[model samples]
Target: MQINLKYFASVREALGGGETVSLPAGVATVGAVRAWLIARGEPWASALSEGRALRMACNQRMCEAEAPVSAGDEVAFFPPVTGG
Candidate 1:
């Protein structure tokens, strides 16, 4: 399936703004999408690694790793935001 991706904050700095991705079979959740990106190596590996403390959204709504994803859905990743 194909989906639009978004990167924000420091994640944007590392992975750039965003891009479209065609996921392989079994990549059905937000976490799976993350794993797929991390599998690509290079900046992706470091940028989306499991160790990173990042936030995710599916279709512009806040979501956890179990969030369902679908074709044409928008998935976003970013460092958590805070205000003082």
Candidate 2:
């Protein structure tokens, strides 16, 4: 399955705009995508680190790591927004 990943705001600045990843089966969740990216090391690891404050969306809808994903799905990652 192929998934499209999008990065926004700080996330985009760290990882660039986006990329497409081809999954080799057994990896089928939003979290899996994140884990895969994190495994890429360096900027990926630091940008999407587990301790980072980030928000995710699947197919343009806000979703959690456990959310199910499939081929052609678009997953987006962005840092939480806060303004006063």
Candidate 3:
């Protein structure tokens, strides 16, 4: 399955900004995707560590790491919002 991943703020900085990646079909949750990304080495590892305070959105709606993912979904990752 292919997913469009958008990274923002601190997450973007850590990942050198956003990118799209093709994932295997069994990567069905946000947590699984994060784990797959971390396997890519430095940038991914630091950006998606378990201690990071990250937020996510699926198809434009806020979601948790346990949220389900499907083919062609758009998932976004970012730090906690600070603006008013």
Candidate 4:
């Protein structure tokens, strides 16, 4: 399946901005995607670490790790907000 992926803030810097990529089916959870991304090596591993402050959105709405993903969905990743 293919999904639109967006990276923001520090994550964008870490990931060198963004691109759309194809993800395998059954990677239904945010955690699953994170794990897959980390397996890509280097910056992905560091950028996606659980210890890092991160936030996600699915189809533009804030989402949790357990949020379900579908083919053609848009998923976004970014550092946690610091501004008030």
Q: Tell me the whole-model lDDT of each prediction, alpha carbons only.
A: 0.95, 0.93, 0.85, 0.84
Badly placed stretches (over 4 Å) of model 3 are: none
Which residue segments of model 4 deviate by more than 4 Å? none
- Which ten residues in a row are the worst by lDDT in model 2? 23-32
Cα lDDT tens digits for candidate 4, 1-84? 887788898898888667777887768887788778888898889988878879999889999989987888888899878877
Per-residue lDDT of candidate 3, residues 1-84 (tens digit): 888898888887777566778997678998888888888889788988878888889989999889999888988888888877
What is the Cα-based TM-score of model 2? 0.95
Tens-digit per-residue lDDT, 1-84, candidate 1: 999999999899999999998999999999999998999998999998899999999989999999989999999999989999
TM-score of 1: 0.96
Judging by TM-score against the true structure, name the best candidate.
1
Q: Which stretches of candidate 2 lie over 4 Å from their true place?
A: none
Please give the TM-score that candidate 3 achieves against the real structure: 0.88
Please give, for residues 16-53, the per-residue lDDT of candidate 2 as tens digits: 99999897678888988888889889899999999998
Angstrom error of the Cα, residue 57, model 1: value is 0.1
Best-to-worst lDDT order: 1, 2, 3, 4
Candidate 2 colliding pairs: none
As for lDDT, the candidate ahead, 2 or 3, is 2
The candidate 1 region of ten consecutive residues with least summed lDDT is 40-49
- Could you tell me every candidate's TM-score relative to the true structure? 0.96, 0.95, 0.88, 0.89
Clashing residue pairs found in predicted model 4: none
